[model samples]
Target: MSLTRLLPILGWARRYDRDDLRPDLAAGLTIGAMLVPQGMAYALLAGLPPEVGLYASIVPVLVYALFGTSRQLAVGPVAIVSLLTASALSPLFEQGSAGYISAAALLALMVGAVHLVLGFGRLGFVVNFLSHSVLVGFTAAAAIIIGFSQVKHLFGITTERKDHFYETVEEVVRQIDGTNGTTLVLGVASIALLVLMKKFVPRVPGALVLVIASILAVELFDLTDRGVKTVGEIPSSLPAFGLPDFDTGTMGSLIGTAFVITLVGFMESIAVAKVYARRHRYDVDANQELIGLGASNVASGLFGGYPVTGGFSRTAVNDTAGARTPLASIVTAILILLTVLFLTPLFSSLPNAALGAIIIVAVINLIDIGEMRHIAHVKRSDLIGLSVAFVATLVLGIELGILVAVVASMLVVFARMSKPHSAVLGQIPGTTSYRNVERFPEASVTDGVRVVRIDAALSFVNAQHVKKLLLGEADAISGGDVTALVVDCSGINDIDATGVEALSEILVELDERQVDIHLCDVKGPVRDVLRRSGLWDRLDGRIHATAAMAVDAVTHPGTLPESLRSLGIDERHDERPADTVDTEVSHA
Candidate 1:
């Protein structure tokens, strides 16, 4: 492994030129503007002091810039991870207490450790198990919950937060009559202003605009005296480095939460990195990205911050702001550091409702309704998986919802694979090409040859189904047992011992019925397995390279030419009379 691979900053820094710095500076300032309001809002969302979010936005951005792979990715606190942080720690400690803050920092450390280990171990591919359907469902549900969880802040009313989504919403609604008039107005107006500005003047940072405007309004008009809650005091100093709690009792309690945070945070970061990398035509190393994110989280935790990830919204802002490199992130970190040092007092008047509005607007984008509808239109099973994830997250907590989503996705996959698609293939008329007989009605089938195509990898999970489907097709024939059964293994990418056993049983059954079972288009690995299992010997010269040759050899015996036969094509025409094909079956 090269040093550049481990420290991605070295790769770009060696080629850094004056031309890149200007854009990086401009983009950095813009991202820093967005991050200030968002960081504080996300910290509140995580049930922590607002400055912790600022603390997170600073060190993580710098760490990721030094070690991360994607040039354009902006790493910091993200909504989903913040919600997860709150969810994970709320039950274990009192919200915003010293114990809660320590737990959050510890969670970040554990999450960082998990990422570092996975990256160093080169186990990045493990994330592939988190199917898109599961993510889609889980994100949409989490977004809704996060949005509703802020409703109390939006209305300026106190309500007990419930674990269940509907219960939380119900409690919020039950307190509707207690809504503070000034807070509601501020929240609603901030949301409207954000929407309008994004529509009409998108180049401007709307959250910054809202935050600044809200702060000015509150301070100028004495809104705090009007029953409007402000953010109060924020420590006007850069984060101080500190070690996280490492006590076995404290750390053990947070291990499970940390694991979930690791998965969610890395998933979010790598996804953003890949998206921007594709646009810039550069490839991102997932494992390297894991190490980068792990380092960022560790840095954040050590510097009095919670777990953070690459946020999609801020990264988009960075890209649109014309950022050319990760230098933009470094500059952004500096600007955030400045904000903590000098600008903290100005934001003391920033209303909680306004920050709540910012969070609401940001998280609203996470709900991918269009994706749900598309999934529903395409695959019912995927839609079910998506639905299961959404509902589970809404009813159960984040951890259980994710658990349900993963299980539901796996179950859906296994259900489809358990009875894998098998088709009866026939040669397209006047062509060497063969297709599903039912799909291509014009195709022709040989009288004595039954060509069955198994459309999935043959594993223990589906071996029995394939065997039964093949036997059932043979039995369905009206005439005496087919003289030859040609099993097309074109789509069978792999075969295990159970699959070989299933084939052995099929061969015996066909032989008892006076049918010669021949295999065609058997993939190399599968053939190797069959040979090792001794099924190849039982095949007795019945395995052909192609379905056409197998059929030709079965129907016309020696008429298949050597070259065409070697390529799995039947050189000879079908000489059997049409009426002799009493059972020319073809179905998808």
Candidate 2:
């Protein structure tokens, strides 16, 4: 491989021209405008102060831009991952407290370490289990939880605890007398303005506008006396390098949370990176993405921020704005740095209700009801999976939601394998190849010859199903007496030790029943597997080169079964079919 291929920025930067500068500049600025408010809102969602979000955006973007593969993917804090970060750390430390912030920093370090390890091992294919449908369901479920979880903050209620969403909701309703009208009005106004901006003037950076307008409303109208809570003061200047305490007990507690963060955050990053790559007609190396993302996370942890990843929404805006290369992300980082230095004071007066509104509006894109409808229509079991994940996230938690989603995905996969495709075979009227007997009316058995097509690869998982189907077909045709069985081996991709054992058992049973087995058209790779395992050594029947060869073999005495010869089954037909039974294993 070329050195430039490994370092994509080298190739892209080599061709960088003044001609591409305009679009990249515009895209970077537009995305930067959007990122400012988004960064702050995501920080709040992650249960940190707004500045941590800005801290996450600055160095991570520059690091990923230099080392990452994608051209337009924007690296930052994302919605579901941010919520997951909050959930994972909440049990370990109090939200917005010093210990909580330290734990959050530690989590970022752990996430970075996991990514670097995976990238070094080139084990990026692990994210393949995060199916697109699962992501759709997970995002929609997260969106609902995020929107509802902020309800207490939006409505402005005082309570002893803000733990269970259902309980908090009950408290909010029961304590209606304690409701703060000013905060409610502020939330309602922000939501309405953000919604209107999203629907009508979406390119205007509605979050920024809402932030400014909400602060003005609070300050000009003196809403504090009416019970509107502000974020109060924020620290100015850049974050200094520091480390979270790494006590042995803390490490033990963090192991599970870190694992979840690694999986969930990495999967999110891969999915978004792949999308951006596809939209831009580029390719992605998931392993390289891990390195780039890992570097970003390490930067985040060192700079006093939480875990960050390739954000889908921000990347979309970046792509749509015509970002040609990762240069746009670099520019975005500079913008964030400028904001941290000069813009911190402006957000001090910004009401928390507006930030909550900004988060709610941004996550609305993740609520995809249509995907659920399509799943229900095309695959009802997947619909059940989606619903289960949705309910689990809302009533239970994100970790439970993913646990249920993975279980559902596994069940669906196993269910399909349990009923591996099988079909009866018969020759077409005018061609030599066999076809599905059920689909083609012309296909039918000639004399006592039988052809059985099994779709799945021969493995212990579905070997019994194939065995039962073959024996049942033999019983149907011969009433417990049969002369021969032909397996169209083009469909049998590979066989394992257990499958070979099962096949041996079947061969013995067929031998006792006076039935002979014939194999035809096995793939080269499968043939190699069989030869290496010495399966062909104790063979029970002749392996024919093709279906026609198998049929013709029975005509000759040397190839004919002992039962067929004794029974005086001598005649064979020359007729054939053009297309044979086609079968193959699906991708895992």
Candidate number with greatest TM-score: 1
Cα RMSD of all models vs. native, in order, equals 5.7, 6.7
Tens digit of lDDT per residue, candidate 2, span 249-351?
7667776667667777778777777777887788988888888888889888888888988877788778888898988998899988998899889878888
Q: Please identify model 1 stretches exceeding 4 Å from their true place.
A: 478-482, 558-588
Q: Over the stretch 1-588, how does candidate 1's per-residue lDDT look in tens digits?
A: 798888989989999988988999999999999999999999999999999999999998999998898888888898889998888788778888988898888888888999999999999987776777788889999998888888888889998867788888889889999999999998899999999998999889999999999999998999999899988999998898998767787787778778787777778778888899999999999999999999999998899999988988888989999898999999999999999999899999999999999999998888988978887788867887788888999999788898888888888889888998888888998787779989999888877678889899999999888888888877654443247788888999999889888888998898787778888887778867886899876774577777876777676554323232335332334344565433422111
C-alpha displacement of 530 in model 1, angstroms? 0.7
TM-score of candidate 2 to 2 decimals: 0.90
Model 2 ranges with Cα > 4 A deviation: 1-7, 159-165, 479-482, 555-588
lDDT of candidate 1 at residue 235, scale 0 to 100 = 95
